[model samples]
Target: MLRAGDTLVIWRLDRLGRSLKDLIAWVGWLKERKIGLRSLHEAMDTTTPAGKLTFHVFGALAEFERARIRDRTQDGLAAVRARSRKGGRRPVLNVDKHALAVKLYNEREMPIVKICRTMELSKPTLYSYVRAANGVTDGPPAT
Candidate 1:
């Protein structure tokens, strides 16, 4: 139960909920009951007008920080792509191994599982090579 004198403490605004709607509802409910809400990390206390303004300012700052982070990450990825540097996981099967696997599978009608076992590869790796040989641009077919 909540009352006017009680204080609701949270580590951070994000820790309270995943969505804006949920956060707004919770904050509104506390405000209606004249209860104070405090965030330790953000130093936001929703009791005085200044505290309320602080909370809103923090929310805006958090949103700005998130956007900046995402922008930086995308820029980093683009730079890597431009340099032709590998971004994600390196394929286990190189060009030679892929050609060999495709040839063995197509000409001999070798079972996929057996081929994977023989090549000491997982099913996904075998599929990736076969897909690459077929001129599929998208990284490996789904296993």
Candidate 2:
């Protein structure tokens, strides 16, 4: 909606966006089109150098805050990695359980239903594990 000589008026700086960065970006876009901004509450007019400088300062502060948040998030993730095996939900099948299931399916000729009952797993879950162990990646055989 911006055009040369046009001005975007707002009740307050916050009316522009939720974040200072967004407001700054909007102001930059307006400036690119030779448009200006006016905030009633702030009584600031981006048609002048002083108003533009004020916006620039807000934008710089927003960028600094964003960097700090990113750094803190990285530190938090590192801390979590230091304490746990992995961050997600526990696996449905672990190494020992997979081994036992494979042994029953291959060596003992145990029925899938029996394996499911013994392992406290559903039939589909047992079949999936057995199929994976048997290298049957394509669905059950046509036979």
lDDT of each: 0.76, 0.73
| Global lDDT of model 2 | 0.73
| Candidate 1 ranges with C-alpha deviation above 4 Å | 1-6, 13-26, 29-35, 83-143
Error of 1 at 31 (Å): 3.7
Q: Assess the local accuracy of residue 58 in candidate 2 as a C-alpha lDDT between 0 and 100.
A: 56
The digit string of per-residue lDDT tens for model 1 on 5-35 reads 8999999876664444445667787877788
Candidate 2: tens digits of C-alpha lDDT, residues 1-143: 66799888878665465456567667777777798898777677899989888766655665666778878978887888899745545657788987897788777687777887887778777777878777877421121
Residue 33 local lDDT, model 2: 77
Q: Could you tell me which residue pairs clash in candidate 1?
A: none
RMSD (CA, Å), candidate 2 to true, equals: 16.7
Candidate 1, poorest ten consecutive residues by summed lDDT: 134-143
Candidate 2 stretches greater than 4 Å from native: 8-28, 38-44, 85-143
